[model samples]
Target chain A: MHSIPGRRLIMGLFLIFLLLPIYWLVNMSFKTNAEIVSTMTLWPHTPTLQHYKRIFTDESWYSGYINSLEYVVLNTIISISVALPAAYAFSRYRFLGDKHLFFWLLSNRMAPAAVYALPFFNLYSAIGLFDTPWAVALAHCIFNVPLAVWILEGFVSGVPREIDETAFLDGYSFPRFFIKILVPLIASGIGVAAFFCFMFSWVELLLARTLTSVHAKPIAAIMTRTVSAAGMDWGLLAAAGVLTIIPGALVIWFVRNYIASGFALGRV
Target chain B: MDKTVNQKAWFLVLPVFLVVAFSAVLPLMTVVNYSMQDTFGNNQFFWNGVGWFKELLDPSTDLGGRFLASLGRNLFFSMVILAIEVPLGIVVALSMPRQGWTVAACLVILALPLLIPWNVVGTIWQIFGRPDIGLLGYVLNAIGIDYNYVSNEIDAWVTVIVMDVWHWTSLVALLCYAGLKSIPEAYYQAAQIDGASRWAVFKAIQLPKMNRVLLIAVLLRFMDSFMIYTEPFVVTGGGPGNSTTFVSIELVKIALGQFDLGKAAALSLVYNLIILIVCWIFYTVMTNAGVERKVQAESEPAAKPKSSAALKPATALKPKEGVA
Candidate 1:
């Protein structure tokens, strides 16, 4: 009973520490650049909508966000689609080199993104995919597919073998059976996998920034360029940072109950 | 789970192989090519096998010095990250409420830092830690702590480490929370019946339940932290000197910034091997410690394959642990 108070105190302090920087980001986003630089206040003084306005009105700024979303969504769909069948095979059947194949796929996830930055740029350009969303989407699969399969396989295996056998006995073909029964049964896993894929692709900067120049430039990359071009637009930079967090927040909101389970690899 | 041995299962796995090959294999080959050959401008190259690698691994040369120095920094940083985040994550996971809307709210807020782009994370801390215009900077100044990350090497290192912990500890906490939640209610009841103390209950029940997930949390954190670039790159540009430069940033500087392709390629291969080797060692050690109770069950002949049914809830539950 005495530990309850201590636990609550620890949690409160940690959450406050976690939110302090974010609070500053949000507070600065609403101020004018002059107000932000010239003085420090606990919150925005003489708040203005001008920073958000600039992002929305400028083609470069707005398109940066759109481009990031385009590639992120593309990568998520591709990662999940390929990972599903692979996950099925791993979960329900054994084949030659399956063990080695799984290890190799997972090792790709562990490789540093920076190592691939130069080569991905060269590879994508040679194939005519440079500066395109598909290039980033495909490049991301090197990391995302392994993660998606790892997560999906965990969830799939948690389901008893009886379910798959019973479905087949009921005269269900593999394709129809997989689409109707197996898919719904592991839909939570799919959601979890998609969120992780969206997240890694969304937050990743080294590969995404290196692979695209103009047409597919991400907002994060654009934010970096803003420093040199505009000589530190503090207000606008904070505003862009705020916008970058929205998609992830929205995704997490949609899958709240499943978050812990997903991180657990869906055993529960 | 019972798995049938069907060579045709390769068909299901083929798509993943092709996609991964295109994305992973081709680029890796290019890295290999760059490492073995000397390159000049206008797409010209000459073979110089193992030369870059020799300079990089030997500590006397400038290239070798930077490589060793940054490798030390990277390994040190990974240690610091794991040291702080793992214990902190376990505490946070333990303290989280078992149920209610509060759970959802907490999860969402914890993920916010993780969801933000890595550069934005650096940007936030960059401005946040500025002694003049930033909140953390201004507060520390007001309290009379001479903190300037840009000018002070110690301050720069501190900022990068704190930023990583802030950004990633939630992931560890979330994974541990999942492990904690999956533990059956009976374990707690049995502990109560035996009059076990709080620490005893945790050590005997909760900690073991979390063993598998904790291994995962450790490895993922280690791999990512060793490769950390954007956050520190933005915050200090790896400066106040080379105080915070990691291998990735150094490789980028040589490859992209300085345009020394061969040296960069060599650095990349050696850097990647270090990560993989460390990972393989940790993984081998952990899995050998009886982590895969499920693998033992599955490796038995199919005709008489018998898993521990009562522990079936936890069986083959080690899907991520086949190569753990």
Candidate 2:
């Protein structure tokens, strides 16, 4: 409690630093181009929903949202499923090369995405997986799966082994035992890992854009294409950017309670 | 409890191994293949046999020079980010309240910036740094400083660094905060009994306990910063005369801009190796610290397991079973 005043001052500074960009972004979304270019206004005098309206009505801008959503969801599901058993194995068994294998899996996350971009683009297209949701989904798995494994491994390890044995002793088969006993123990962990997968996959644009042109382009890509003959549509772009935040915000809101604690567990 | 699970544990990990290998090994092989070969469209190849690697490693070549320059800039960016964010994160974490909804709220706010996509972060800064309407830009110009991120090298670097700090400092702060929260109150109480100063308590208690997580934070931030591309790409297009171009940005230019698959592939491999080495070194140091902590903590541990017992209420909790 002695640190109250000091804490407040630090937090106040943090709030300003964190929120200023968001404020500017929201402010710019409402202003007209003429206003944007001519002079700086702290807040738009004439706020309009025109940009938001444009994002919804315009097919080009609208589909980026759709594409991003489809792939991000796909990426999350695949990564989590793969990570589950892997994490369980690492937690439960001391197999040959287990430590080395786990470390090797994590090293994939450290691989520069730029190095793989060209190879992925070429390889996916050659196999007819390019320009599809699965390509991006698969690409994201390279890194996200390892992260999911590392995180969930922590959660799974913390669950007592007695739980697994008891379920088997109760005459449950291995599959039934795992489904009924093991998963619920680590639900918060899975949720936290899933949220991260979704966030990373959603935010990724370079590979998403480079891999697809029209059929699978994401909203980030759509924003890039919006600068047409009419010129850069600041209002519309800002609106689309704002809308992009919604899905992510919803995810954060849902998992906000567990995130801190889950991280604490995962780090251990 | 039994000491062993069945050998069938290998079966559980097999599927993941295959999926990750398919995702990682095959692509990496392809990159390796491309790196060693010379092609002039139409799927044609000439066995170059380390030609591209040699050229890149040499200082005289254009690609080599660019590679070194990008690597230097990447290292510089990582250093700058660590310097600003680590200490700031410590300060923020030190100031954060210990318990209740206020702590949770601060954490949620800290997590918000981390959730936004990389490109969006770049876009936000792009719009937010506009001198005409941007608050920062407007204020800077109002103060008689000529600020233009797109045209000026120093301004571009400044903007990129500031944006990176804003977006990532939260991660450090949160990790440090988590480290701080794990410190039991008995340490503080003991310190109070000893009449220890705030700085002394921090140095002796909190700092040593936080060393492990802080190392993780530093490693993650450094690797991410070294590999950064999307934000700087969107904001400055790696322009203002390449002052803001990092390794990832350079790799993208070689691969996408020039379509030089061979050179790009070689460059990518080199970049990946560099990141791997640095990260491996970081992990080794951190693990060593963990060993030291274990040795140190054994002497004067804080709190009973009762504090964590609250999380595992045996009677209240339900059994869970599912594949995931």
Candidate 3:
């Protein structure tokens, strides 16, 4: 690739802009509340892990992470599983109402979670799924499923139809072909789809907060509520904030090679 | 790319249809129901039939005034965010390192902000903007800028907008980078051979290659920013005198804060409709772009076969996908 002038400087400055606030959060997490309030220190003068320790020791604090992960994992699985077949169909066939169905799905992806939060609360509660990981997981499917389908369809389309015809001619059953031949061929696509499912579900707050109360409260919700109840314990809030970024960071690292292509939804 | 007319393919889509229906259709019906009816205290309810809708649309009414104001704010915010983030994102994407470990490091850092929970993003800025303890606020004050995100309308808007730019610009950059990566090296070789100016090269080659992803980026950014709730809600709490309240914030306040279900439901429908219309426009434009590209590819092969082979994959993959 041809190099642009001052590209390094431009990139360097943008990276710093992104990292500075995060560095502050991490910096604040390690400082005591007294130090946080008393001084504007770039680095924690008396660096401590008390906030981290508190989160680990408190059931309410720790369970929040587990709850968030449980629902996020559940939602990712549900979204990707359903999306796989749908993506194949969309990519390969002209089914009845295919265009309308596809548009409807995309519309749901654009639907504001705030619009759905109340009805989800009512629907989930009526179904006795409220305040469970299941409620949050299912609610998230409204968006994630559409996105998974959209991404996976692009990847599935990239695979030549010749592959499917070959599998069928070789006497492979549809399910077996999907699993044994097709799935492995588009494994990266699935990875990309799952990554997005995980990302959106993990980061979302409005529906997750509405659908769960005590039993399945996500860490994000817990962070907000605890901050309000306990007052601004900046250290604890920052620690919790730092912890939330870890799962995402780890996921991104594992998919680092695919990040750009994945962000393109595999179309690139 | 010829698709068979296989209606049996609907079976493949059944699982998705059922799940999304159970999640989307059911809730939407309930919203429609609530939107048309008024609720008294308790489980007692009576038919108000379009009353809420009337009140919602009329600017003289309290609900209408708040809705219109917040809707305007949301539109302005989305416009501002796109204006700043799009060019900056393209610049950042262009500036991305061509190879090696720095590429990985930069990608990871660029993506970091996007993955943080929205409220935490808000909280980060909230703390990072406090004049007493936050580095950003403290340094600005020390420099005699007299900046505080709280208690000042313009300061609050600036903080929210900057925070959004921080949170989402990476997404735009990542999408553009992906677009740029797909451009064949041959295009650049041709540009260099022709002694193309940098501006001409970008305008002809890079910008065209980046068009599809740029559209996706804009659509996603616009939709998400228009429906923005969590971050600004956390940072400003729609405060410093409701100066930064967007439609979502106001809707939430009506729905959950005040428990005015009827008005909230009506507002929700309108808010969702606006997004749907805008989304439809983008979908149409994007699909049209794909069609236009396909025509170009077909005609270009007849005109000059040499470059068509390189252009095929980029154009072929451009269609049949919606927003991420």
Candidate 4:
């Protein structure tokens, strides 16, 4: 293969550009608030674990992460389960309004979360699911389900149709064929779809913040409220920010091999 | 790849339809209803049909002026983001190492910024660009440049744009990388036999191979940038006197901050309509592109075996035609 000139240098510089801000955040998370405001240092002069300790000890701070995870997991499960059969259907058979239905589903994915925030609050409140994890989970389905279906459909199409025929020839029922035969074949697709569902649900703030006031506030929302209520405790805020990146980092690490194809939604 | 025509497939898709409709259709109805009604503090409402939409489109009204100005800013921002990120991403993808442990390391690093929560991304830049103690800002000021995002409109815009580029360029690069990976080695060998220069090889082979993924990258980036809310909102708070406020921020302000439901609903409908139209265009174009590629592939039976052999791995893992 032909190599581009200055390839290493280009990659190295781009990586640094990406990491520098994160490095700054981590650097500040270790310093005292006074040091953050009063001095400029390349590294922490007196590095402390105080911010992390504060977050670990405080219920309001830590519960924010728990709340975030609760909705994220719920949303992932809901999105993938519903998307699987739909993806299979779209990949395998022609149905009435199929093209229009697929277009409508994709359109929902393009709908801005800001546009849905007020109505979601009102809708969830009316249904008595307000301030609950279920509200955010179900609300996120508006986008994640379509995305999951879009992605999983690509993976499903890669599987030859003969497998479904063979399973049926062996006298397997449709549900049995799906769970016992077909699901295993597209497991990675399910994983990819679930990863996306988790990522979007985890990062989203506008709807999560709007639907839940106190009981189910995500860590992102908590960080915002902390800044306003405590008046720029920069170290604590930085510490919280650092924690939010850890779960996603772990997820990316696990999916590193599939990262490129997954980002393309398996179309590549 | 031929699919059987079976209407019973609707049963399988019914669950997704119901869930999405419950979430999408109901709120949409509520938004339409709110857009036409006048409300008071006591929940008393009057039918003010089309009044809010009239004001929203008229530019002479305060709401109309803010909407149009923010819409213009949003367009400019999306254009700038695409202009910078697309070529930069292609360059990065071309520069990527082919086969090594370093490939995994580089991929992980490239994806890190994407996984960070959007607000946390904002916080990172917010802290990084602070003029007092932040590294970027302090270094700029130390070298005698006047820089502060809080007080300067241009600085604020630059910060938000840079933050977006940092956060999303990896997506484009990764997509391009996948496209490049699917290209067969025989094309490069043929170019070498022809004594093709590096630029010629890229123009003829790599660029055509990358077309589909490039389109996908552009569409995703444009939509995401146009709807961007949390990052810029956190970094600048749409401040320096609303100079950095995009449509999402302005809409949220009207809806959540000021509780002006009628105006907010009207703005939301128009905003969503624009996205839906653009999305439909991209969808049509993409489906047509896919059909053209399918036709070309089917017509060239002589070259099919070699290309299919090279594409076997990618095809087994992910067939490219399901994008429609």
Candidate 5:
């Protein structure tokens, strides 16, 4: 192999390029709003925990966390439950309209969420499901189900047919075989699928912003209103942004080990 | 793998089908309904019968201009994103450590930007690009380049594009990395034995092997860039004389800001059709190529035993034409 210093230099520079914005974000989050706007300080001169304090103590700020958590859980659970069987069917069996159906499902993923946003708002409003957690949870499934199905199908296909046959020979019913044997085998796949579902629903803003007025909105939606009354609370906004990164970061950290071979398994 | 049908299994797929249908089919039906009818503040819809579509497609109207301009921008933006991200992603993936904890750490860091919510990404860039306070902005101004995303069209476009590239480049990288990782070492060994140049090895061996994953990467990037909304919307709000306005932003303005439901629905449907058509074309081409590859791989006589093992593992297991 070539020990190219040139390649190493380029890679190092790329790494720094990738991390600079993040460093800037972290640096700004620690600074006082005055310093943020008034002076060009790369590092905070007078770094304070006041923003962090406000995010924790303030009702409006903390409420965003609660709303986001509530809906993300609901969305993940609903999406995965539906996706598992569909994925299994696609992976294990040759069926009627199988290719067409699989393609159709994937095509849903390509549909811009924007196309349906207005219609969804109207539909949810008409059905009186507007401004609610369930509405966001349900709406998320539009993209998540297709994604979940696609990922899970990949994982399930990798599990050999003999495993199912052995379980059946052991007198396990199809559901029993699937639950007791198949699910355990594809546990990592399910984990990857779950993480994706959580990530997508968690980060989504447009429908989250449009659907709810106040009561049942996610943190991403609440972040929009952080500017009101206090003339753009940059401190609190930065704090909230930092805090929002925690759950996702944690999820990614946990899922990182599984990611490499997970996709290879036809799952992630 | 047997043809023996389990009719009871439909029950399992039923819940998911119903949920997805409710979310997807219902809203779609609603859009269809709205596109064909006009409402005048009483919740009563009158038959419009393609009138809104006619007006939306008419060249004289601002609505038409807004739609066309945004669509053009989106197409261009998607192309720019594809050009930068795909090649860059592939290069990064190629350079990645072939094994161990370093590879894991790199993957995690690459995924960090992807984890952040789109709005926060917008916020991060919005504040980070301020000439008065933002690091990039301040540095650029100090260097005498008067940078301002809020007012400058070029700056806004660059910021939006950069933000997207930063956010999504990892996805392409990760996908390509998967493709590369699946390439058997024997091929590299053979290339080394043959004393092939690095460029030749990559072009002949790596690129050909990565076709399927690359297909996936391109399709995903195209779909994502085409429908991109949140980051640009929050950062630029499609401002500076609508220079940065992409299709989604325009759609939102027409649908929500102007409250033109019928026309918005019509425009939405048109946008959906464009995406659908493009995606269909990509899908068809990729699948056809995949089929060709499978046939070629199977039909070709044993070229070299070394080459056989060196062949990509991904190509080995891909569907034989209709398997997907």
Candidate 6:
């Protein structure tokens, strides 16, 4: 506990810096545009839920959240399922092009979402997958799948080969051993990986926004258009921003340890 | 550690290959196709044949000048971020409490800014920096400092840079903390026994151990910062007279906003090539680091598990699989 005061000071300063914008957004969300512009109070004066009320009651506003959730869930499921077997292979075996294959997968992650935005818009339309959640879900895989594979490969590699040999000796089929034995063993790895897949898919907007229109428009797109269309509804925009953060905050709380430790295990 | 040379393992990777190929390759091929042609509406394209590419690469041309300017801005942004975040991250990671309840608390707080969607981050900051309404803007003005991110170019840049630092420094700090956590206590004990100074211990032990994680942090930050679009877009709209127009922002303007598909495609290919080259550079650097560390192990009998443990868990703690 020596130098406890110093530690407290540094932590205090850092946390305040970290939370200020978030606090302000939340504060602004409770104030009307008039109060927000005219009065500069740390706390909302005449606190109102009108901004949030507008979002909740409006179909365009609320459906944007639903649309975002729809694709993010789909992408997470798709990324994890495909990445599992692929990650398993890279971990356990020396296949042809295995090294090259892994690098290739990761480079796809390095591909800027902007670089592919226009082409994806074209390709999705060509394949008749445009204007739907599937387009964004599938588009997000370009990055999410690579990340999932890398993280899963880490936990997979940590698994001892003797376990596989023992399962075979115990007369378990490959699929049976994999499902009944291997998967149950690395459930944390799956949890960690799924959480990250969900995170990346949820946050992405360039690909998501470009790939979808009204039928599958994301909350982020809705947020941006609101600014341009209705002029800056600072209160409404602030409320939307605050709402978008809740799901992410909840996810972070759930996977705080996994993200901290999982990166240590998975990447470097 | 020796494994079977199974040819059938390709089957396992097939689905991943197909899905990613569908997602990555087909559009990439479209980008390639578009780059080589000129489209003048009505879904008609003529064989421009490197004309757009020529215009894109030559800084003298109108499109090329825009591309070059934005590319320079993006590079500058990446450089500035690396400069600020890398050192700040190390200091923060060092200050972080290594054990007890604080670990979870620190992780959750640090993780908050990162998990926010990019556009929301922009919106949050946009409001936070408003002169009339924003706390930051209001506070700065109250303090008699001139600050207006809306109209001033330098202010816009500073605001964008600060927002990025706030949003991403935690990622670097978190990665560094993980690296610091993996350092075996024996290294410290050995240093203390030798009467090494704190700087000496950090130089010889902590710095080397952090090299790999630092590489990961740097590469990830570099790529992400270079490709930044949405956050800055929402905040400034690349405004104040193209002061904040990054390549991605410029590309979108050309391709989607202006409907200049051919020029956008050409520019996209160039951008992709640059990013690929960066990835290659970092990949090779990391691989060489791995190989050099391996060579050092082979030459020194003192190196533990010299021949193996080079890839997974080189100096990392083995992840607990007993959780299940």
My TM-score estimates for the predictions, one after another, are: 0.93, 0.92, 0.96, 0.96, 0.93, 0.93
Q: Stretches of candidate 3 above 4 Å error? A: A228-230, B305-324
The DockQ-derived docking category for candidate 1 is medium
The interface root-mean-square deviation of each model, in the order shown, is 1.8, 2.0, 0.9, 0.9, 2.4, 2.2
lDDT of 6 by residue, B1-324 (tens): 666899898988999999999999998888889889987899998989999998998999999999999999999999999999998887777778757988788888988998788889988888889888888998999999899998999999999999999999998888888888777676665455455555555566677878988999999999999999988998899999999999999999998899998899999999989998999898789779867876875766655465433322322321322111
Q: List the residue pairs that clash in candidate 5.
A: A154-A266, A155-A266, B187-B310
Alpha-carbon lDDT of model 2: 0.82
Each candidate: chain B TM-score: 0.88, 0.89, 0.93, 0.93, 0.89, 0.91
Q: Chain A TM-score for model 2, please? A: 0.95
lDDT tens digits by residue: candidate 4, A63-158:
999999999999999999999999999999998999999999999999999999999999999999999999999999999999999999999998
Better of 3 and 6 by DockQ: 3
Q: Name the Cα RMSD for model 2.
A: 7.1
Clashing pairs for model 3 are none
Q: Write the per-residue lDDT of candidate 1 for residues A1-268, one digit (tens) a residue.
A: 1122377777778899899999999999999888887888888769899999999999999999999999999999999999999999998898999878987888888999989999998999999999999999999999999999989998888778898889999999999989999999999899999999999999999999999999999999999756665588888899999999888899989988888888876653
DockQ per candidate, 2 decimals: 0.66, 0.61, 0.84, 0.84, 0.58, 0.64
lDDT of 4 by residue, B1-324 (tens): 677899999999999999999999999999999999989868988899999999999999999999999999999999999999999999999999989999999999999988899999999999899998789999999999999999999999999999999999999999999899888886676555455667766776788889999999999999999999999999999999989999999999999999999999999999999999999988898889978988877877876766743443333223322221
lDDT of 2 by residue, A90-117 (tens): 8888777776788778889888788888
Docking class of 5: medium
RMSD of each: 5.5, 7.1, 4.6, 4.8, 4.8, 5.5
Per-residue lDDT of A6-124 in model 5, one digit per residue for the tens?
65565566677777877787787798988877878778899988888887898887888898888889999988888998888776766666667667677787888887888788888
Candidate 2 lDDT tens digits, B200-289? 566667887678778888888988898898999989999989788888999888888988989999998888888888867875786587
Considering TM-score, which of the candidate structures 1 and 4 is the better prediction for this target?
4
Q: Which stretches of candidate 1 lie over 4 Å from their true place?
A: A1-5, A228-230, B282-291, B295-324
In candidate 1, which residue pairs get closer than 3 Å at backbone N, Cα or C atoms, i.e. clash? Answer: none
Cα lDDT of model 1 by residue, B1-324, tens digit: 457899998998999999999999998999999899997788999999999999998999999999999999999999999999999999998878666888788888887888899999999999899998898989999999999999999999899999999999999999988888877675565455455556655766678888878988898899999899999999999897899999999999998899899999999998888877876766576547533666754664452447433333332222322221
